[model samples]
Structure formats: C-alpha cells, structure tokens
Target: MCPTSPSASIFGINTVHRMSLQSALIGFLISRMLPTPLTPQQIIVVQTTAVATGTMPLAAGFVGILPALGLLSEERDGTPPIHLTWLSAVGWSCSVAFFGVFLSPPLRKQVIIEEQLAFPSGTATAQLISVLHKLPPPDTSIRSRRGYLHLDTEDDSAEPTGRSPSSPQPIDTETDADINEREFVQHEGWHALTYSFLASSIMTLIAYFFPILFSIPLFGNYLAKEWLWTFTPSLSYVGQGIIMGFPTAVSMNLGMLVGWAVLSPLSKSQGWAPGAVGDMTNGARGWILWTSLAIMCADSVVSLFPVVYEYFSDLYRAQILRRGDSSSKEDHEVETEDRLVPYTWVTAGLLISIFVGTILVWVVFGNEGIKPWATVLGFILGGMLSVLGVRALGETDLNPVSGLGKISQLFFAWIQPGNVVANIIAGGVAEAGAQQAGDLMQDLKTGHLCKASPRAQFLGQMIGSSVSILVTATAYSLYTRAYPIPGPSFPAPTAYVWLSLARLLRDGQLPEKSGVFMFAFAIVFGLVSASKTYAARRQSPIAKWIPSGVAFAIGFLNTPSFSLARLVGGIMDYVYRTRYARDGNDISLIVVASGFVLGEGVISVVSLVLRTFGVGVISCWGCGHGLCGGCPAV
Candidate 1:
C-alpha cells in the first residue's frame, strides 16, 4: 500500500483545505516578492556548487570581497584579494544555468513528505503531527510499541508497546465526506497571508538577530573571526540544525572547530621541514595515493574477521540452533530482521564510494615522481593516524582541513613552506566529509519516513553529490579569483605553517606533544564520564567531572570569550533539555529553537541577495554619508 500523505487529512477538513490553498497561494506570492523561489532541485544544485567552491559559507566571499572593494571597511588585517566582477558574473551565471537545466525537469514533483528528516527520533513532520493531534507524551519504556505517547483508548491492547506502533489507522473516508463537499467553495485569503507572513517574518528575525545577541560577550570574537569577514553559507548552526537536524549540524560544527581551530594550529606550531610540509598540505598527491593503497590492504585484512564470524554464526543458527516450524511470532521476527539489511548495504556503498573517490582524487592530483612504496607507506601512516585521531579526540565535527593541518604539521614536518596549501586542502577535505556524512543522514531520514528504498536514497545522494562536485569546483574557482586572500596573510595558514615547522625542528617527526596526548586522554575521560553519568544520578561526581573536563578543554583550545560562550550554551542546553523537553505542551519550544536556526539561513540568503543587487545593509563605522552615505545601495 502507498504511504499516507500528511496533507490528505487536511484535505478532508473543508476548512483546513481552504486555508491551506490560501496559504500556499499567499506564500507563493510573498516568495516571489522577496527573492525568486528556488525549487528543491534548484536548491540541491546551488548547494552542490556552493560546497564545491568552498563557498559553503556564502557570506565568507562577500565579506572579504566587500572589504576589498572599499564597500565595507577592512575588519581584519588579512583580506583575500577577490576579483568581484569576474566572480559575480561567473558564479551567478553558472548557478542560473545549472538550476535551469536540472531543476526544471523535476519542478512538478509533489512533496509527499516535505518535512525535514529526524534521526534516532522521527522527522520534524512527525513531531509536528504529534503536536497538532495532541498525542500523548513519549513513553520511555523499551517494550512499548508506540515510540511516542498515544491518545488514551479503551482497548488495553492499544496501550503503548514502545516500538513504533503500526502506522496510525487511516481515518474513515465517510466521516469528512459531507464537510469536504460543503467547504469546496470557501476562500481563505487573509488566513493564508497571515500564516505565510508569520512564517517568513518569524524565521527571518530570529535567524538574523538571535545570533547577534548570543554572540554578545565571548562568542563575539570567534564569530567575528570565522563569519564576519567572509561569506560562510553554512555559518548559522541553528539553520543547519533546522534543515539537517541537530545532530548532523552539531557534528559539522564540531568538525570545523577541531580542524580549523585545534588541529591546524597545533600542526603548524610543530614546523616540519618546509618541503615536506608543502607536499603534505599542497594536495599531498603522493600521500593520498599511498593512503588509498594502504586502506585497500587494511580493508582486505579486516574483511576476513567479520566474514568468518558471520559465516559461523549463520551456520550455527541454521543447523544446530534451528527450531521446529516457525510460528507466527517467529515469522514476524524473521520479517523484522530484514530491516537491518538495508543499513548494511548503505554502509558498504559508502565505503565503496570513498575508495572510488580517493582513487579519482589521486589520479587527478598526484605527483608522478613519487615512488609507489613511499606513497603506500604515507597512506598507511595517514590512515592509522586518522583512526587513532578519531579514537582519541572523538569523531571530529570540525572541518577535515583542520585535521589535515594537524597531520601535515606532524608527519610532513620535513616538507616545509606548504603549510598554507595543507591547511586549505585539509579544510576542504573536512568540509567534504561533513557534507558526505550529512548527506547520508539525510538519505536515511527520507528512507525512514517514506519507507523509500535505502538503495534509492543512496543513489539519489550519489547523483546529488556528483552535482555538488561541479558546483564546489566552480564556486571555489570564482571565490578564489574574486577574494584572493593571499596565503601569507591568512591567519590559519600562517599559524599552521609556523607550528608545523616548530614541531619538526624540535622532534623530527611531528612531536607527540603534551597537547596531542592530552587530547587522546580527553576522549577516554569523556567515555568514562558518560558511563558514570548514565549509571549514576544526574548530580553524580562523574557528571560533575564531565563539565569540568569540557571546560578545561575549552579553556585550553580557545580564548576567554569562546570559553564563556560555551558555558552560556551549556546552561541554555541544560535548561531546555530539562525544563522545556519535559513539558508535554512544549512543542512550541522546539519550533522556537528551530526558528533561530531557520532565521540564520534566511538572513544569510537575504544578505547575499542584497549584496548581489549592490545593496549593502552593513556599513563602515565612520563613512560620513549619513545613513545612506556608506551603505551599499539597496
């Protein structure tokens, strides 16, 4: 049977149908007024391009570009030299052409399930449905069939079972037949306008202003350094949460922080030889090639262990452990077992893609002169380090660039003067990893919601990612051309090279410094803390240590302001999770939080649109043109 549509019920409600139609129309109109509405396909295309071009944060280019053009004052000492005219014309033209060709074909695709996918939880759409229907609170019981609370029913069997209960029974068709007929003629003009305006306004204001408020004291500096000077399309963490869901968004941010702020800086400090560092950072063509071969070897060896175990388990289950004819309950269990098969396939596909992608990269960028043996060794070492790094630091949410920076600084300390290239490549790889992981999560979400084939979703993602590669390449080229931030002046590159050189001089290979060791130690500490907190009460000694450890790490890595910001975020997270999360009627709270995230995206998009049109909302402090003098004309 086909999956039920969320809007079907609304159509059954005469009043709701009328209201929805009106709202959609009004939304359509308002969207036209603000900026051209890009369809989902168009958005996909744009996103791909943005990511490829390293313009994932769209604001980064504009921020830098504007300052260079004397439109906005230089906020920092180092601004990339960007050729605006060329970048703008090329980027916009490509974006327009790609969208026109690709999105137009799928413009009419109906949104059967338009809500953002939620993982480990359900989609936001499910949450909205539960809220609107006033479903019962979620039951924590493991065996309950309904994962969430359901309305009280007289039947005992209908009570919470904890696994997701069978899809809620379909509503009777006849119940709303008469109402639907009577409401076919009703108009909902004002209601539509109100909702659309409300959605847009609420989203816009929150996204734009809330971050500014949150960044007031400590976060202010980091925010300024990372976002203010450049067009970072994915700058707003909240927006990421809303669109991609919280976990994915948070993970991406974590990766970025680790790569950019933590790993890169440390690598540069170690100062491996300039030549070695250069090779590592500047494409590390040799290293990547060797790494791929090493991975293949390791993968081959590891496959045997899992394959043998699976083979034995299957044999035992089918032979000695086999029972008599399976009953209905056993049959049901067998059917449910199939659910896990899809996840396995998805994982396998991802690994294959990674291998293929690495090969392609190596072929395109590798050095011909590097011997296969050295490359292989480098690859093995890099892979080993990556694994260890992940184990020690936890899977970084920071950009891969930072991670690469760390690796280059440490291992290729002998390869000097290429720290800048290393940092950029590292950052790019980190970002790509984030995008890949996020894409997978999103695919999983869609699969869960629609029961769409995982294979299908994976295929779609592959297609989507292919498009992204083109977009990324184009965007990067244009951005580099327009806002050319010289490598020498870029803070990240300078710091990275400096540190990497130092480490090399001091310890030969990147010294396993106290900081690196400490980082690994922190991972163990985090694991222990998590276990203790879960086992003990909320206020247990272990729980106390968790926060202190986190604080210490923050202090070690960041400035006072950053530490302060984290503290504030922690307090807010605590309050929301404890207080708001518990309230049965607090659905609006999630929306509010989501609003903040959505607001960030909207503001970013809007700011970009304005800039594209030569309108500057932000201006220099002392440009003497009254309010109008310095600001870019709208």
Candidate 2:
C-alpha cells in the first residue's frame, strides 16, 4: 500500500457514513442518545481498523489479479465465478499475513527503534489522532457522557477525567492550555471538510450531467486533441497530488513531458510502435509502459541493496556471533516481552497460513500451479523483499510492491520458463507480502508513537486482513460484473503494467531495439535514484532537483491530462502552505484534500451503480468528450 493518503483513511470512513442521511442520522442520534459516546481509546481502535482493512488486498492486488487471471482483455475470458476468485483471494490474503505477522515482528527493533526512520504518513496520522482527541466536547448539549459527541451534563465536574472518583487522575495540562487553539482548528477543519465534500459532490454530479464540465483544455485544442494535454477538471487527482507532495507531482509531470511530449512523437515518427500514436495497447502507450516498468523495477531493486545487506548482517550477528558470545545482544534489541506479539503465535500463524496458501495455489491453478519447492522459494523471496519494503517505507513512505512483483515475475520467468500462471502467482505472493509487511510496519510506527500494545495491534491486523479478503474479492467480482473494467472508467493501468511484464518475459515481444534502450536507461536511472536517496539522507541541497524514478515511472504510466491535474494540485499545496498555513501545520488543507478525494470517489461509486443499471452516460463537448474522445463513463 502507498502512504495513508487522506482518501485512504479518515475521509474514506467519514464520507461513507456521511453519504446517507439515515446512517449519519442514526450515528448522530446514537451519539446523543446512547449512555456513552465513543471514547478516545475506541476512536483509536476505529482508526486502526480502517488502516488494517485498507491493506491486504490493495488496489494493485485487484489490478494485477484481473490481468493475471486473463479476464480484463477481449482476447481473454470475460469473468470467473465469485467462488473461485474469493478462494484465490483467501490464498493471497494468507500469503500477505505470513509476511505481515510472521516476518514484521523481528524487524521492529531495527526499523522503528534504532534507525528511527520517519514513516511520514504514519507520523502524520499519529499527530492527527492526538489533535482529534484533544478537541473539547460541545459547550452545551444533553450531557457530556465522556467523548466528543454527547451533551454536557449540568455538573461538568462529575467524573471529569471519565474515571471513578476513587481513581487517581493525572492532570491534562496540555489539553487545558490548548483548548482554544484546538477548538479553532477543530471547527475550521470540520467546515473545510464538510464544505469541500459538498462542493465536490455537487460539482461531480453537475459534471456528469453537463459532461462538458469534465474537460477544461487550457492549452490549444490541437495539443489537447493530439496529445491528451488538457486539464482534467476533477478534485480526485488534485487531492491525491496534495497528499503525494509537490516534488512527486512535478516528477510525474516531467514524465508526462518525456513520455507524451517527447517519446510519443519520437516513437510515432520512427515507426517504433507501428500503430496509431493514440492506441493504448499497440502504440506509444504500450511502448512507454515497458520503459517505465523497467526503470521503476531497476530503481526499486537497486535502492534495496544497502538495506538488504544491513538486514542480513544483523541476522548473521544475532544468529552466528551472538551464539558464541551470548552477551553480545545490543540494548536496542531488548523489547518489553509483554508488549510484543508472542513468538509462538507468529510461528503458529505462519505455519497455518503457509499451509493454507500452498494448498489453495495448487487447487486453484491446477496443473499450472508452481511446484512445492517453487512455492517455498516464493515465500523466501517474499520475506526478503518485505524487509526491503519496510526499510523503504521507513525512509520514504513508499512501498515498491509493484516493482517487487515484477522482480519475482522475472525470477519465475527464468525458473518456470514461459509459465505465466506461475509467474503471476509467485509475483503476487511477493508483491502482497511486501505490501502487507510494509503497511503493518507503518501502522506499528503509529502504534509505537501512540503507546499502543503491539500484540493488540497485531490481533486487530489479523482480523481486519481476514475480513478484507472477502470484502476485496467480493468488490472485485461486483465491479467486474458492473462495468467493463480495463475500459475507460476503470483503466487498470497497473494491471496492464503487470501484464506487460508477464508477456515480455513469456513471449519476448519487444520492439526491435526498444528493450535494449529501456534496459540501458533503467540502469542509469537506477543509479540516479540511489544517488538521490544518498543525497537526501545527507541533506544535500541538490537532492530536491533529482527526480524520483518511481514518480517519473508513475507519470509514464498515467496520461498527460492526469499529470497536469496533479501538477495543479501540487501548486495549490505550495500556495496554501506559503500563504494560509501556520508553519505548514494547518489542518484545513488536509481536511479539504480529504473531502475532495472522498466526494469525487463517492460520486464515482454512485456512477458505477448507475452504469450497472444500464443508465446512459453524457458526452463531454468541451474537450471533445475528454481530450478528443476517451471520456470515462459518468
């Protein structure tokens, strides 16, 4: 999973309940009428659950699985039975759990304690949770039972700390001093979130009806028509860009500049792709995707070399040297035993999940399933990659799971030789493992900051991940049935990225010298990526100028219009921080961005429902129904 963007966490939960008056009203009435509203501790559990459920079957998992199963394209099967997909999802979920639970615990001392690497999103979330709990209850209501929602009773002094009178109470000096400040921020943040959500929701509905409102071609019509270089008038990308940061948004735009403005025209002129320039599959789009994937894979693998060495070196000392010395254990190595997830639990969980996953793989894929030895190899590689992923997440707040999958695919291509089924399964195992492990580690970082128990968090993670298996599988089945995925509305670009790698390894289908060029460029970019990381760690001034290979790869995958919207959003972030924000900690920006993403996302879901019912879509006229045709269904 990527960093816990606003869309991924708080806003997503808020909007779902807010979308229906019945749900919202019921929640409201319950808060007011019930004996007690949610406590701060309960609120933390809710947030933790949201984070937990967001992992396991990520969007990438869905994207990769669809193409891997050969269900997204015209030449492949339409869809499979939900039972089959659900069972497969079960296996996938278990594989992720194996790494998340069994593999993640050992590294807690190194990743979270010693190195103290800033998992930025996790840190942000921890801060947000702290601020939220600090907000005072309503001034006047039925009675303030305990938490934020309920009315204040006449005697406010009754159980002031929500504790029994006999219990010792610690003074909340921080809360008392910051009450006014917290109140101001709370009210403003709520207004921003609410107003932006309403505005975006209304605008989205309007855009769907008007159609022309979806497109806003700031540049000339010719460029918009020819190269998809237009402004997409939507808050989704803008919100994503704000959370993703300006540097990345700029990097993606640079990729668009190279891929669309430079490479597309170059490929067309040179007859490299040998098809219409605009064709997604056979033309410049397909051609550029390979290069993007190559660069990203290279960058990801190269960046992990140092971390991998350190991880293994630590293991060698603990396993080999420590055995001889017995007293060589470092101070940082010791953690509170009671706070830790028990080793017995980890061992048992791993054994059970691994057994289940292995059995399911053989059953699901039949003859094409990887052999038992190959399955073991996949797990080993997956565990190795999870370490790299956790390290990357610690440092940069990005998990290169897609690259991890491609790496596994490449390895399997050589091992299994032309077995795409084995290739996808192995790759999926590694990708899911890395993703789950990294996400869990990020959450652990949050848990550590919040002083939450690791054992409890792990249990919560297990339950949430288990539930996610069904939820994600059901969602994938429903969405596939509801709409023609890999089509305009659900492009599944990452799925194509996965498929492209599989085909390349399977069929050796590469344009003349393109593969050679891509590989060569990948190596150079990989070096540049490593150098950028080094410089950033050293606080070198030149680090900011060095483009992120991952971001550029994202740009290569996305259209120019999408990149343009992200660029606009990044600029907005810069502007807002410079002008309106206090020390760039203003809560309004986060709430607004969250609202933008949630509102648009909720509307998209609504549109998907409409599509399922065979409601016709309106065509945009402004930019020829989305940059000279290619408008997604509304």
Candidate 3:
C-alpha cells in the first residue's frame, strides 16, 4: 500500500509505490477499450471502481503473504524451522483485508468527517473527479491550506455530474479523432499525464540498459561524488513531495534532518556509530533506524493519550454536558451510502481475520517462539496504528506506514524478544491494515466527488482485496520457488528486514546497551508531543508550528535526499497551485504531473514483469550489463 502521501493531482498516482496508479490507468484504458469513447467523467468512475478492487488488495498482500512466506522461507536448523500451507498464508492475508473493510466506517467518521484531515490524494481525486465530470459549481470556493482539509461549503443539490440531479449530459455521436483528444484534455486533462507517462517510461527503459549513459541525475546519479550513499534522484520522490504538500513535506524534512543531516554527521564525528569507513549512507541508516525506532515507539504511545482523551471527553460532553450542534441536517446529508459497507460483513471479516490469524501464527511460530497473547497484542496494535496511519494520511496524504510498522516490530520484539518471524508478521499486519484503510479512502474520495455508488466502491474493495490475495500469493510463491532468495528475480527486500533481525536475535545480537539512552530521548520528545497535544486542544495558534510528531517520524522512513526531493516537489506544487488554484479549472499542471508519474509506474511494471520472466527490456551496446546482473537462465 504505497500511498504517495500525494497532492499534485495527476503525478501523485505514479509516485505511489503500489499498484494504485495501475487502477487509474487501467480505468482510463477501459474507456479506450469501449467501442464508444467515454468522456473523462465516465472514465473516472471506471478508474475509481477498478482502483477500489485492484490497488488495496495488491498492496495489502505484503502484510498477509510476506510474513508467512518470510517465516517459511527462513532456513532454521538447516531447513525451515516452522511449516504452514500456502492456503494458510492466503487465508491470513484475506482475513486482514476483511478487517480493513470492517474498520473503515468508524475511521471514516472519526478521521474524515469529524477530524477533517487533508487526505491529499483523496482531495485531489475529488478535484480530478470534478474535472472529469465537468460538474457545475455551486458558487464554491476552496479554502485550501496545509494540515486539515476543508470542504468550505456543501452544495446540497450538487452531484458528481456538477449538475442538478434533474439534469443529464447530452449524448452525442460526434467521433472526430482530433475533437475527441481535445475534449479529453479539456475534460480530464489526460494528455499531459499521458505524455509524462511516455517520457518517464522511456527514460526508465534507457536507464535499465545503459546505467552510465543517459544517466538521469535524479534516478541514476548521486549528488557530486556519491555524497549521500544511494542519493537517488527519483521522480517518485519529487512527486511524493508535491503530493504531500507543504506542512507534511516540511515536517518530514525536519525528521530527515534529524536522522541523516544532523544525527548521522554527529554520530560519525563522535566515532560512536559503525559503518564509519564505507559510505556516508551507512551512518545515516544506522542512526535513523536506531534513534527513530526509539522515538517512534515512545511517540506512538504518547500521541495516543490526547486522541483517546479527546474522544472520551467528547462522549462525556455529549452525555453529561448535553452539547448540541446548530447546523441543519441538510448541510450534513450525503448522497452516497451512509454506511459504505455492511456491519455484518465487517463483523464476519473481523472474526475471520482474528481466527485465521491466530491459527496461522500458532502453526507457523510454534508455542515457544511466540505466545498467543503476543499475537493478540500485535493485532491490537495493528488495528490502533492503522487508525493513526489513516488519520495522518487524511491530514497530510503522507503514509506513516513504514514508521508505524517499525514501531509495531519493536513492540513485538518487546513482547517476545527473540522471535524474528513474530516481529515481521506483526509488522506486516500493521502495514497491511494501513494500506487497506488508506486505499479505500483514496478510492472513496474519488467516488464521493465523482458521485459514484458507495456500495459499488465497497464491493470493489472486497473483491479486489480477495483477488489480490490469490494473485499475489501465487505469483510470490512462483517467484520464490524459482529463485533462491537473496538472489536475482526474487529479491524480497521486505523479507530481508525480518530475516536479518531473526538472525541477530537468534544469535543474541541486540543493539548495544547504551541504546537505552535513545529511549530516554524518545520519552522526552514524546512528552513534548503530549504537551503540544494539550496546547492544540486549547486552540493555541503556536501549536500549528510545532511540527507533527507523526510526520516527523515519517521522515526517518526514507533517506535524506529522497526527503529533499519531496520538499522540492512540494515547493513547485505550491508555486503552481497559487497561480492556478483561483480558476478551479486549472488542472493542466495536475494532468502533466500525473502523466510523468503514470509513465514511471507503467514502464517500471513492464520492466519488472520482463525481468521476472527472464527477459531484458533493452540491450546496451557498449556495456553488456543489464539489471539482471547479465543474462542468466530463468
């Protein structure tokens, strides 16, 4: 669930790490596939529908299948220490996906409707939907800002069609190719997005063969002389920044500053951190992983106190204080299904997830490796952290999943110190939960603006997650079976984190005892965060500049240069948005951004598929090197 934490409309989709962008493109292609060329409005509905079913589940599998496979893949005692059927893995993943669907409604209320988080991608999708449908405005104004999302006013009579409910778009048989293309640009702004997709894909293809030649700075080269160690100049990072916007971008950068720019250099100078010899990147990684983990774990606990207290306090006010709202019912009414998915289905899904999850954990990890109570705690944290993840997404469109997952991993470690598999699976659930929730909301936001059927969106989510479980599991299994892992073909980067941790724990290698000081520092930062929460509750203006604890933690998840790229993108977006946002019709820039992102994703997908199937996407004449470490038998 690689939610881009995006904002710059079109480009954000490609910046996302998962297949969400594919859903958008696929939907667009579906329109093309139709005998009659549909307008962008119709295509958006198609896109939203496809995304609901496609993106969520595919990304969600990392949580479900990866953990079981991770444990199964581990060669303990000269063979896999634990055993479980592939069906069990699929079942575990499905159950988690279902839990996501179950949990969405409550979260939608608490985070979206109540808290009014930005949900940048969601907001952009809504705008995009408007453009697609060419909806008429209700004399609306966008109070665009950083942090929170505000739908300044609700046009009670407004629909996705941008027309009164009684009106309908005229059906036309006009079929001039030039007219169609111009109309596509006018309505959906697809042309710019298409061009970007083509350009980036071409560059990606060129980079694949000639890593040295046509070497783009962002994707290929480091700054000056390998200064930052894997300082990738990627469009994805830039797109991410643009999508996340100013508040999130800046806060994340602050975190990056602390991790790489500040801490890494400080640690290196003191000669305290390892990886002193090889590259600067190593120091950055070591410090951030160590310090950020401590900070995030503490922050996770401290940040919750305010939210929980606020929730309860609200309940008390509603009950004892008897507080009441003055807004009219018409102002709040929505055309879509009030409850997107049925409570019955959610209950079933929750039960199944817990039941299957319990069986899977016990079967795979065994009694000694982990306790049942630990697994329960994992699911609980996963559930709770998912809310936090979704809330952050709504506010900043920035996914805090990696940071959240790391915290979950640490929590599991505390519960059962030595079991690496337990840590990984626990982290997986948290990550997956975040993905499912975020994916649903992203789709729903588009659906809401497009006035697509909520029930259809819900159904799409369920079906997509289910299908993805099977597809991801099968494909993963095939790839793993074909390639001896830590080899070409099946890199399984996610698996590496757990495997490495398991090895260290199994061999009794934990972080140094001095690392406890980091915990102390984390506590200080967390308490400060708690203080900020109190100030925010009082509506103090100063709280706005406090820098989000969650967003800061998110910064440590990626490298410094990547964070820098996002900041740059955010700045550019701000510049363009300031000029164009007034019209409410200025979507060409958004379209351009989208094109670039989609191109990157589509080309990457093609390249990945080709690589997996033992084919090279291109050939380099001077250098015989390919991404596959030169051609080998598949």
Candidate 4:
C-alpha cells in the first residue's frame, strides 16, 4: 500500500505502516460516519479490503512507466486516453487477481503454516487492528442506559488458535487488572504513535523549506559533494532501519561502502562509464546497477531453489502418493480446511482471470502486444516467481518485485527478442503477479491470526481489487497529465530503473567492463545468501554475522545518503534496546517507527497536492542555499 505519494514525500514508509495507516484512517472514518459501530468481523473485512485494494495499485505504477516514456500512443493533448489508461489498469488488476487467487493458495501451507515464515507486516497490521477494536467506546455505558446503543459484541472465535513467533501471544483470560494494563498499553502506544507522527510531519514540512535540514554533510564536504555521502534528518529512513533491524542495516551500509566507495570510483577512473557520475543512462550509477541487480537475482534464485524443489516434491507426494490428504488430520489442519479457500472457487477464478487477462493484454497493448501463449507463459512464470517474492516477504519482510520483474524481462528478451512493448508487458504482468500474490499471502496470514474466515478475506480482496481498478487508473492518468514523469517533479526513479533494464535487455547493451564484476559479485552474494539461509535453518551461529544479500543489493541500488541515514536509524535502535527496551520487546520502537513513517507519508501526499496547485513552500531560512540537494534556492 505504499502508493507513491509524491517526489517530495519522505522515504521509508514501509508496507505494514502504510496498510495500517490506511486501515486506521478508513476504520476511523467509518466509526464516526456510521450510525452504529461495526462488529469485529466487519472491522476485519474493512482492514482486509484496504490491504487488498492498496496492494493492487502497484501495477499502475509499473505500467505508468511505459506511457511516461512515450511508449504508448498519445492523443492530441500529448497524453494517453484516460479511458485507455483505465482499461490498462483493469488488465493489470485482472493479472494480479489471478496470481493472488491461484498461486498464493497452493503455497500458503508451506510458507505460513509449516515453515511459519514471519510476514512481519501482516502480523503488525493484525496487531494494530486488534488494538483498535479491542475495547468498546467510552460512552457506551451512558448510551446503553438511554436505550440508544448496545455494547459491542465480542467475537470469541476470532481468537487465534496458535501463535507465530512474529505475533504477540494472546492471553487465555483477562482479569480486571489485565484489562486495565491493556488499556494503559494501548493508550501509551497511541500516544507515542500520534506524537511521533506529528513530529515527523512537522520535520518534513520544515525540511521542504530549509532543505539543508534534510541532508547534513556528516562525512565532510568533499565526500558529501563528490560521492553523495551525507546523513539525513528524515525520520522515515531511521524508522525503516529500525524495522529492518540493526544487522540488516549494517549489511546495507557495508554494501554502500563497497559500491559507492570502491566500485563506483574504480569504474569511473577506468573510463568504463564516462558519463556524469550520477547519470542513470551511462554513469557509475547505471554501471553498478547491473552488478547490484545480478547480486539480487543470484540471491533470489539461490534462496528460492530449495523451496521450489521442496514445493514440487510435496506436490508429487500429495498427488501421486496420496500422502497430502491424510484421513486423520491434525486439529490445526482440520480447522484450517474449514476456513481455507475452496479448490472449486480457486479453479473457477483462475481460469476466468487467465482468459480475461490475456485478452486484455492483447487489446490494451494494440498491435505489438504479447501473443496469448506468451502472455500465459508470463503468467506461469509469474506464478513460479511469486514463490520467490512470497518467501522473501515472509522471511525478510521485503518483496523485490522490481528484481522479480527484471528476471521476467530477461527471460522474455530471450524468447521474444527485441520487442520493447512485449518485454514491458511480460515484465509488468510478472511484477503484478508477484506483488499481488505476496500481498494476498500476507493478508491471509493476518486473517489466520485474526481467525477471520478465508472466504471473507478473499471476497474482500475481490472487492478491493475492483476498487483498485478505478483508483489506480484515475491516479495514473491524472499524475501523468500533471507532471512529466522521469523528470524533476516526479523522477519516477523505479520506473526509470525498469525502463533501463527493459532497454538493456532489448539492445543487449551490457557494460563490458562491469561484466566480470557483475558475474563474480553475483556468485559471491548468491553463496552468502544461500549459506545464510541454510545456517539459519540449522540454527548455526554464523548466520548472525552473514550480511543480507537483499539489503546489500539495496545499498547498491540506493544512494549513499539514504544508506547513511539508515545507519543512523540502526544506531538509534541499538540505543533504545540498550537503554529502554522492556522484556527485550520493541513494542514502543514499533509504535514510534510506524508513526514516523505514517506521518511523513501522509504529509507528503499533502505536499504533492499543494505543489500541483502551485502552492509552494517559501525558503525563509538561510539553510535554503544550495549546499544540499533539493534546495528551493537552487
């Protein structure tokens, strides 16, 4: 649900926080607007719908890249038809819905049940929902006596039967004292979240005018100016770092050190990339992106292979040996089956989505569209790759949809060589599939914890997806019409990266000097990631020291300034743990982080709207001078 708010929006608002923020906003609105408060089941439905709806719009971002780059036919107004854009969004929604319904179901048991991979975002959102609806309204007693209201009915069945390590364990019973304690905790949590949110929002607004406040040159002016090694005051990155954990942050900084300090300079000095240092087309940034992408790909492949092998092995046993469906199932299995999405529903949805999605692709893309067979192949590959995405999200709480999309691009390039439109569509389908599948799995995880019916959640997903078709389409069209994407106002950095990869695949323009480095680094990172996964599973101590490949690749992908800010966040987390943590739990830290992310994100959307209206911030402070980037004075 981390919809790209604006170019000015603060970074680091993660998926969990975004979803929670949206859910909170919607839930609050419903409570205030409705004549009566919703039941717990109704609340669950609302939250799930928000999540599903938010998850679907990512496809708009992916497809928006094409039109932004002038790949699509433009009307006389120099914009794609709004109707056509809406249709494209519908096509994307169909593709995403297919994977969410089809691919995710088959693997839920492996990822969420047997392995118990921590979909941390899901767990957090579920916790937030619980807190929000845990108690009745304060005025309920007064209103009930007047015969105007009834007490909120508690749904005892919603209690989780089992707890995953990532989620808080529910108490068996609540005494008066327990209830009081819970209320106190909730009060404190909400207080911290509210204050932190306001603080971050104020800081973001201030930084917009005094840009130097956003970027401090901590590593001396030479490094800051030359290599972009500056620290930032933005709480968003710090919050993100806190959420990702200290070790991962450290790993990311190490990657930044290697990429910016070592490889970038080395490549530039050797004339491998003679363009401007930061230029995405022919600069050090572009040069290193390949190696970074390779590392991510290698890590993804290495981490996924064992899981894929096991999945197929289990499938073989289940289908061939009849071992999957034991007559005497465990209690959990029995409970799960009662609420699980029925196979008949999945089969029907899958077939219909496949047909509709294929035709939509052909129609939307016009003459250079992907063939139906190729589109279906893309869906198959997307389904296969979604396992990789889902596993990543489950384990690390990061979904590398861009990396997944690039992999699809490479494959389509080989099969349907040199067709840029075909390549983008294929990659976009794959990206949407992976994204939607991962999102659905996470929602399912949340539902599992909440003990909400799977059927209800799935239905919520469909409704939300329908909503997404309209919302994403409108937003994409309006944004494209308003601003020049890939330009200063929007940048659309991820879209640029996607376009770059697509063109590279189309033209076969490998940076020769970086080829050996990419290959070698990919292998090394792959081994490191695979080894870490193996060691972690075996409870080996060495896993603690191993750098996360995904984080490392992210370091390479992002600027040094962002990495430094994250390092600051990691330090803050360590300090908090050492000084103030209770029972080794980071409940307060989570609250504060979520607040920071949500605050900046919400304000940034406001900023975007203001900027669009030509209502700009004034440079009233001396810090507005162009020492740091993005200064209004510049």
Best by TM-score: 2
What are the runs in model 4 whose C-alpha is more than 4 Å off?
1-43, 59-181, 215-226, 323-344, 391-403, 477-484, 487-493, 541-545, 620-634
Model 1 scores a C-alpha lDDT of: 0.29
Q: Candidate 3's residue-wise lDDT over 1-634, tens digit each?
A: 0111112121222234223333454455446556886664455445554564454433444423353344444355233544335675566555465666666766765555444455556555555444434443222222232223345435355453222345543445223433443365555655556666677667656655544332223333333123242333446556556655565578778887776666666666666555642121244344455565556556656655544454556567556534355342222325545635566766787777777776666765577555677767766777787776676555435455555666676677777776666666666666666666766776665555555566666666667666767765554444444334423222222343444444444454434432664666587778867776566545466665676665665566454544666677778777887874544334445455555556654555555565577765354442222223233322
Candidate 4, residues 451-561: lDDT per residue as tens digits? 667778778877887887777666655655545454433444455456556667766678757779988998899889888878765556777579878678778866676
In the predicted model 2, the residue pairs found to clash are 143-151, 143-152, 144-151, 144-152
| lDDT by residue for model 2 (480-515), tens | 666545543455567677766776787787765578
Q: What is the C-alpha RMSD of each candidate to the true structure, in Å?
A: 14.6, 9.5, 7.7, 8.9
Q: Following a full C-alpha superposition, what root-mean-square deviation does model 2 have from the true structure? A: 9.5
lDDT of model 1 at position 174: 27
**TM-score for every candidate vs. truth?**
0.42, 0.81, 0.69, 0.79
- The prediction achieving the highest lDDT against the true structure is 4
Q: Candidate 1 lDDT, tens digit per residue, 248-315?
A: 22323342354334543444445421223223332221112122222222322232232234345545
Ranking by lDDT, best first?
Answer: 4, 2, 3, 1
Cα RMSD (Å) between model 4 and the true structure? 8.9
TM-score of decoy 2: 0.81
lDDT of 2 at 197: 77
Q: Which of the predicted structures, 3 or 4, would earn the higher TM-score when compared with the native?
A: 4
| 274 Cα displacement, candidate 1 (Å) | 22
